[model samples]
Target: MRITLERSNLLKSLNHVHRVVERRNTIPILSNVLLRAEGASLAMKATDLDLEITEATPAMVEQAGATTVPAHLLYEIVRKLPDGAEVLLATTPDGATMTVASGRSKFSLQCLSEADFPDLTAGNFTHSFKLKASALKMLIDRTQFAISTEETRYYLNGIFLHTIESAGALKLRAVATDGHRLARADVEAPSGSEGMPGIIIPRKTVGELQKLVDNPELIVTVEVSDAKIRLTIGEIVMTSKLIDGTFPDYQRVIPQANDKEMRVDCQSFAQAVDRVSTISSERGRAVKLALNEGHLTLTVNNPDSGSATEEVAVGYDNDPMEIGFNAKYLLDITAQLSGDDAIFLLADAGSPTLVRDTAGDDALYVLMPMRV
Candidate 1:
């Protein structure tokens, strides 16, 4: 079997699918990518049992056939080929080796029977919907940083996606938490999303989906079942297994009675925190926020090293109070704010604090305090 395709087209498709192949695999077939050439198109697929990605690119198919080869090895070979060059993939009579010829370079890679490759069979989808790429990107970017990495609480390792009626309108919401901080973002629910069961998209899938949604004009089709989800973007199709666990109710941790309010320039506050935290040790880098009427003092004390203090004027007029927070957590939440001013609603030095963006009400964050 033989097929010829443009190097650019082959490279793009491989770039999208090869990422799903794990670097190290216990199974031999799992390390290879399945390639099928048929009807003027070449389809490529790679999987790690839990997640699978498939993409098809246009090709001149002289003979239709299928085989498997090392995913990363082939990708590297195609990537090094000259731009705009054509690539020819041909298999021998015994299908023992595949030849990749492009320009003056040729490579012979050991081949495996396509039948040996596994397929992640998606039985049926209970809900399917379409969403704008920009909207999807917003929800992911706002909350991805808060996803928990603790293996024990597997439920918190992914973003919880569901629909809810808020302000008399149905909205699609994404929430993630690590017990210390929580991020929640919302977008207007698209049609066909109503009554969809909430699903926890695994962390790996969210990362890959984020990379594909860079084009704001693209429309992404989403199909979800109880245990698996499939996303179609342009010619690329991605299927991933959903994390099977119950996500803790994150709303209870969000403070509702945080009366003390503080408003400060986002950039200035972030820079001050960064400068002060430089003096903090690597472990338990806590920054103390001492708030007074219209003034805030940021301090970091490291007994082994030194101390740091900076003052910034704020819009606070409440009773003065001191609160402690992780320097890294403060910076993470601030980076997600797309506004000039960051609003912090505080209850006390121990309870959780709520953060909001002045630019929009679509996203919010709650951060737990650290002992300083």
Candidate 2:
């Protein structure tokens, strides 16, 4: 195969697909990206068994053929070439190696037969929908931080996506939890998204999808079945296998009757927590919040080090109370808030606390308290 394409165009497509390839692989083909030169374009594909991404770019093809080359190596070579340079890719007649030439630099990469590359056969999709990129990004950004990293509980390793009737409207929701904290966000359900099966999207796929939805104006096409999901954005297509486990009932964990409420400036409260938590050495150290009529005090104490305290004014009318929470968890939840003020609903010192955004983002948070 012999093809010539603009370096910038090739590099952009490579950047999108090459991230699916893992550095270490038991099968050699799994470490490489497949390149197919056809009529007027070159197709680039990479996969890691669980996830696959493909993209096509216009190229001048002298010969139509296909081959596989190391994904990272090819990406690095094209990245260092001169901007706007023309790149030439040619494979030997014996199909053993491929030569890459750009400007005055040239390199050869070992090739694998295209036949050896595994294809993630995406079966027929049961449901299809179109959603604005901005809405999709909001769902991921609000819940991704709560996804559990524990491998033993595979069900909590991704976000739970489904449609439900809420407030007299059909809404699509994303929920994620790690036992200590939970995040839930909702958006209006699209016309074709009703009665869709709930799917658990793995963490790696969620991260990649978040990167591709930066263009807010674009309408993303999403296709889903019981076992897989496919997303198409412009010339790029991403297919991923869903987790085969059942997600727990996250709605049961959401607090519903917390009557005491306190409203504080989100920025000031987060800054105070950060300042006081600096005295502790552990990441999950508990920070105590002491609430009064119109003021709040944050305190952190570490026996090995010292103690720190910061005060902030809040709008509270309930009786005085104290609650403890993980300092890191507090920061993670605060970072996701899109409002100037944060509202906290508390039932007791031992029960879970509910948090809401003043910006009316249709997102809610549940945080378990820690013993001080």
Candidate 3:
């Protein structure tokens, strides 16, 4: 196989596919990327059994053929090459070695047989829909931070996506939680996604997919089946197997009758949490929030370290309440709010507190309070 491709294009495609290739693999072929040249296009694929990424780039195909080469080594070689340099790749009939060339530099990399590479079979996808890139980005950014990392609760390690009817309108909702904090966001569902089954997208897949949705105008095509999901953005495609466990019912955990509501500037609240958390030790990053008529004060006291307190003006007319929460959790939830003010709904110091963006009710967060 022989082909010539632009260095920049090759590098960009490699950057996406190479990340899927594991540094240490039990199978030799898993460490290599499958490169196939056909007509005027070249396809690069890499996989780790659970997830696969494929990208296509325009190339001048001298001879249509396929071979496997070390993904990271090839990526590094092309990355160090001069700008706009043309990359020439050719494989021998035995498929034992791949020769790479650019200007005065040439390198030979050990290759594996293409037949040894694992092939991902995309099962029949029943539900397919399109979503705006910006909308998808919002869903991921808001909820991914709350995804659980505990391996035992495998189901909570991903974002839960499903279609729901709210206020006589169909909405697509994404929810994630780690038992301590939860993030939920919604967007108008596309017309055809009315009866789609809820799916838990794993954390690794979410991280990789988020990298492809930078363009606000680009529309992403998503295809989902019982076991796998495929996301298509531009010329790139990502396919992954969904977790086979049941996610806990999250609705029951959300507080329903929290009467105390306080509205504070998002920036000011975040700053106060940041300053108060500085005095908290590593074991317990707790901060106490004291609320009165129109004033909110944040306090943190650690036996090992010192203490800190900060005050911020807010709009609250409810009875004076005091609550304790993890400072990091508060900062993370506040960071997701796009507006100037954040609404905090509380039942009591022992009960979970709900947070929302003052701009709208489309997104909501629930954070479990800590005992000070």
Candidate 4:
């Protein structure tokens, strides 16, 4: 196979697939990227059994053939090449080595038979839909921070993606929790997803999906089946196996009767949490929030370290209430609120507290209080 591709285009496609290739693999073929040059473009594929990514880019193809090369090594060579340099990839007649040449630099890499690469066969998809990139990004950003990392509760290890009817309109929702905290966010349901089954998108897939939705203007095509999901953006396609587990009913976890309310500047509250948490011990890192009529106090006390306390003005008209929480959890939920004011709905000192952004009603967070 022989092909000439622009350095930028090749690098972009390589960047997408190399990330899907695991650094250490038991099978040698799994560490290499399968490249196919045909028609007017070249297609590259990388997979780790659980997830696969394929990208195609326009190239000047002198001959049509297929081969496998080291994914990361090729990416590194292309990345270090001179700007706007055209990269040439050609395989030897015996197909034992692939030669890469650009400008005055050249390198040869051992080749693997493309037939040795594992096939990522996608099952039949029952649902197909299109979501605006911005909406998809919002759905992921708001809930992924709360996803559980505990392998024992594998159901909570990924974002729970499903559809629900709310106020006479169908909405797509993403929910995640780790027993201590929960995050829920919603967006208008895309057409054709009304019959979609709820699925648990694994954490690795979510991270890769985030990279594809960075551009707000792009519309992502989503295809979902009971066992797999495929997301296509332009010339790149990412496919992953869905986690086989049932997500707990998240609505029951959200507090509904919390009456006490406090509204504070989002940035100020985050800063106070960051400052006071410095004195918190590493084990718990707990911070106590005391709320009164018009003031909120954040305090951290550790047996080994010194104490820290900070006061911020807020719009709280409720009676005095004190609750403890993990400082890092509070900061993560607060960071999701881009609005000026963050609203907190409190039930009491023991129950969960609800948090929302005054600027948007589509997202909410529930944080379980800890003992001070």
lDDT per residue for candidate 4 within 296-315, as digits (tens), equals: 99999998878999999999
Return the TM-score for each candidate structure.
Answer: 0.99, 0.99, 0.98, 0.99
Any runs in candidate 3 off by more than 4 Å, and if so which? none
Candidate 3 on 1-372: residue-level lDDT in tens?
999999999999999999999899988899999999998999999999999999999999999999999899999999999999999999877778989999999999999888888988998998999999999999999899999999999999999999998889999999999999999999999866779889999999999988888899999999988789999999999999898888789999999999999999999889889988988999899999999999998999999878999999999999998999999999999999998999999999999999999788889999999988
**Per-residue lDDT tens digits of candidate 1, residues 1-372?**
799999999999999899989999999999999999999999999999999999999999999999999999999999999999999999999999999999889999999999999999998999999999999999999999999999999999999999999889999999999999999999999998999989999999999999989999999999998899999999989999999999888879989999999999999999999999999999988999999999999999999999999999999999999999999999999999999999999999889999999999999999999989
lDDT of each: 0.96, 0.95, 0.93, 0.94
Quickly count the clashes in candidate 3: 0
Q: Could you tell me which 10 consecutive residues in candidate 3 have the lowest summed lDDT?
A: 190-199
Clashing pairs in 4: none
- By lDDT, the better pick of 1 and 4 is 1
Task: Give Cα distance to truth, residue 348, candidate 2, Å.
Answer: 0.6
**Residue 44, model 3, lDDT:** 97
Residue pairs with clashing backbones, model 3 = none
Q: What is the clash tally of candidate 2?
A: 0
Better of 2 and 3 by lDDT: 2
Let me know the TM-score candidate 2 reaches against the reference structure: 0.99
Error of 3 at 300 (Å): 0.7
